[model samples]
Target: MSLALEFVSTVRADRSGPVDTLADVDGLTSWARAHAAGPGFTASEEARQETVRLRQAVRALFARAVAPEPPSRADLPDLPPFKEALALVNATALAAPTAPQLSWDDKPVLVIAPAAETDEPTRLRARLATAAVEFLAGPEVALLRTCPAPRCVLYFVKEHPRQEWCSTACGNRARAARHYREHKK
Candidate 1:
């Protein structure tokens, strides 16, 4: 999975409640360490708050994409934060030095390696923004769907043709709900 997809999954929903992995400074730090490979990513209260805001904006954009009615240009979700994040990512990419190096093996293999930079958080954010834009603009946008299970608020990229819910647990919940509805009738 791409880092951007993993970032989106950080905000998960369960029966207890929605778990925002980026809720606090510590959480943000932990997430950055795990996903962004940035053990030294700065974690401040302001950063946590900014992450939350960006998460919400990203979620809103997904919601609009998967909505039943195609949103008009005026009705499209505003993505100022995503734009900012993308800019940061673009700047980082532009600054990165990519050079091909030959491996010291009997069979030589060439690889393009990017220079190491310390801007971890910005890189992660840029990855996420780029991914979101790609997902929205790509043909797979049709496969993007919100979970239909009761109380399930997660979004998933549908893999199977018959897959409806986000997971088997959600599928069971939806089936149980349908059975209960039938019994009630």
Candidate 2:
């Protein structure tokens, strides 16, 4: 699965974050169901709030793992949702080895070669693991970065080492702002 999809999947309450207890996998199934129906599945106000909470919680968790900030592990709660998500993320991170090279295809495809293919979740996790490695290992890999768009936290492997924007939309906006400033001078 694509990084964006993976991110969405991880955040949804149906897939893996729904279970109240870490031992039960029902929460993951709930998350998957919620995710399949789309973000709008949060029909009620309470559900909406819960969805938002989950999204923020999951995003923070991922951001911290990929881009470590500080020592706040003590403040965290022992929630099953967090534990399950962290396990998935960590496992993926581990699977994502630092390969010296990656191949390019005319068709956009991400091939994941892992031990298990029977489980959809496992396959998804493995794919993410491969992607993490690819993002970390590719040329200009240092430039591999997440979208700076506030709500858009998707990752992209930059073709240029010095790339600052994830797309022309962002780059153009930044340039326009600069030009506006220059004209004000």
- Candidate that would win on lDDT: 1
Q: For model 2, what is the error of residue 110's alpha carbon versus the real structure, in angstroms, after optimal superposition?
A: 16
Clashing pairs in 1: none
Q: Give lDDT: candidate 2, residue 176.
A: 76
- Candidate 2, 1-185: lDDT as tens digits: 34433433342122232322112344444553443333322233343333334433444454444454321221135323556655545565554233333447776555534443333443433444444445334443444355553233344445676776556766776677778889995
Looking at model 2, the pairs that clash are: 13-31, 14-30, 14-31, 14-32, 15-28, 15-31, 15-32, 16-28, 19-27
Tell me the tens digit of each residue's lDDT in model 1 across 77-121: 433454564554345345434467888778999985544553555
Angstrom error of the Cα, residue 17, model 2: value is 23
RMSD of each candidate relative to the true structure: 5.0, 11.4
